[model samples]
Each structure stands twice: as structure tokens, then as C-alpha cells.
Target: MKTIEIKCDGCGADITSTGNCFDYRLALVVETRAVQGPSVTAMAVSLPLDHDHHLCGINCLDQWRDRKRHEAKLWSDWNQQWKEEHATKDPSGRILAWQSPPREILDARRPEFEAAALAAFPMKVTK
Candidate 1:
């Protein structure tokens, strides 16, 4: 017979048969675009493989969860501020125009978005 040991991804600790561990996996869709000299190509969509995370015990799991929540909240606040600052309003104080944020800004917020999604639809496995 052969024995296989799984190590915790978070702390690199050996996971025994009776030890506690957690696993989470998520799938994400990504869009990319290309531009030529005078024309822009349509966006391309790709669904990459799911991201997997493993934790050694309850403490690491709690920390991971809390960090995600915090990141999501931060993203929410920044998004609100950006909208308020960039929104175009009419005389009646109604939003007349809006534009999608720049790619750099969206990239910065990617972690927050991922965190929110992970928290919302967490697929946790315990052993």
C-alpha cells in the first residue's frame, strides 16, 4: 500500500487524517481586448480554470475570510467615491453621463471583486 500526504497550502503543514483543513475553489471569466492602428477589436472572453485555496486550520481560514470582507468593503468605498467624482450631472442634479473606469483602475479593484465573489459563493471543503 502507498500513503499520500496533503500539505496545507496556507502554512505548508502536513495534513493528517484527523487534522482540520479547508479548500475553496472558484471560476472566473476574463475579458481582453486588442487594438490596431485605427480599429479596435471586439472583446475576447476566456473562462480560466478555477482558483483553489487550502488552509491548515480554523485560524487561517478565519483570517482569509476576514481579509476578503475587508477588501470588498474597501472596493465599495472607492467605487462610490469614483462615481461621485466622475459622474456628469445636469442642472437638476441627475446623472446625465457616465463612463466605464479605466483599465488600470479596474485592475486595481480586481482583488476586491474576487474576494466578494469568493465570500458570496464560497465552496468550502473541510476534512
Candidate 2:
């Protein structure tokens, strides 16, 4: 079997020094420009733990999530600017092609996306 080394994303504790095990894992869905088509493709990918998402314990996970939530507004602003600059629009004003940002940037905007989703389709509560 192949072995890889990893550390605790939050505290930078050497996770592999003792053994090849970890407390948590997270993956973010990211989009990419399709090679053969005008459509974009999305997939769940694992990025470096120390990047945007973190792994180790519940506390670290919570911290990472809180950070992402706090940056939602910033991400929204950047996303609008990015789209305006990079998107290729048709004559009818529909976007024909677009290059997506990295996973970390997209992951950091989860709160804004979730809020938009909720607004589009409000979930009904039942007892």
C-alpha cells in the first residue's frame, strides 16, 4: 500500500508521525471549464487541509466553517467581479462560457450559496 503524510489542518499537528490516520475529512464541489464542450463540469475534490477547509477535530471543523461564513460577503463581491470579467455572454445575455475559481474560493462562499438556495425554494417545516 502507498502511504501519504498529513497533518492536522487546524493545529499543524503531525498526524502521520504516529500513524496514517486522521480525525476528519472534507471535500468541496468545484467546477471547471470542460475540455470538449462549452458546458462546465463540477466534481467533489479534496484540497490541502490547511487551505480553506480544515480537518482534525470538531473544534477545528467549526472554526473553519465559521471562517467561511464570515467571508461570504467578500466572496460574493469577488464572484460578481470575476464573473463580469471572465464570463462570455451570448447576444441574448446568457452566459455561454465561464471559467470557475479554485475550490477554496468557491468553498469560502458556501453561506451565500446556501442562502440563495433557501430563498429560491423555502423548505416547509412539518412536525
Candidate 3:
């Protein structure tokens, strides 16, 4: 017999699915594009007991959703601000932009976004 430990992504709680039957799995596909290059898409599927984004239960799932929403809003705010500040405008106020802010800048702040979201919705032990 072998033993493996899995942790929930939302709450970082240990998930013991050996005898439990209410575990939930979520499949996600992420697409990433560079500021001026081709895009890359990746798919992830939750396995039997192994998944990158695992949740202990419904509460954790809710928390995860909240965090994701917050993070998305942050990104949206950044983009909107950047566009307003950097977009080139003609006499008629017609704005033109070339994917402002650049990918490198966004990538550098990825950790900050994650941290802010986590801080707003800290993980809790669900055991």
C-alpha cells in the first residue's frame, strides 16, 4: 500500500479522499499570450486524487471563486488605467493602442496580484 497526500488549492487543507466520497474536481484551461507574440493554451484536468486546483469542499470552492474574481478585477483596473494613460489619441479623441503596459510588466506584478487576492480572502482550515 502506498500513501499520498493532496492539498486543496483554495484553502491549503489536506484532502483525504481515501474514504470520502464528496470530493469535487474542476477542469481548467488557461490561455496565455505575449504582448506581441503568439498565444499558448494549456488544459488541465483533475485526476482521481491529484489536481492543481483542488478544493476541500464547497466553502473552499466559494473562497476560490472570490479570490479569482478579485484578482480579475485588479487586472481589469490595471488595464483600464494603462489604456487611459498611454493610449494615443487623435484630434477626434479616437484612441489607438498597441497592447499597452507590455507583458513583462504584467508578469512582474502577477505575484502581487495573487498576494492581494489571498490577503483579501485568506485561506482557512476546513477540517
Clashing pairs in 1: none
Overall local distance difference test of candidate 1: 0.60
lDDT string for model 3 (82-104, tens) is: 88788888888778764567789
* Model 3: how far residue 87 lies from native, Å: 0.5
Error of 2 at 18 (Å): 3.3
Q: State the lDDT of candidate 1 residue by residue for 9-115, as single tens digits.
A: 33345554452656442212344445558865446844452354556667556655665666667778877778778999898877777786899989987976766
Which candidate leads the pack in TM-score?
3
- The TM-scores of all predictions, comma-separated, are 0.45, 0.33, 0.65
Model 2 lDDT tens row, 39-113: 754577544343343255665555445544545655677777888789999998777888988898677767676
Q: Comparing candidate 2 with candidate 3, which one achieves the higher lDDT?
A: 3
Ordered list by lDDT, greatest first: 3, 1, 2
List runs of model 2 lying over 4 Å from the truth: 1-3, 19-54, 81-127
lDDT of each: 0.60, 0.56, 0.73
- Pitting candidate 1 against candidate 2, the one with the higher lDDT is 1
RMSD of each: 10.3, 12.8, 8.6
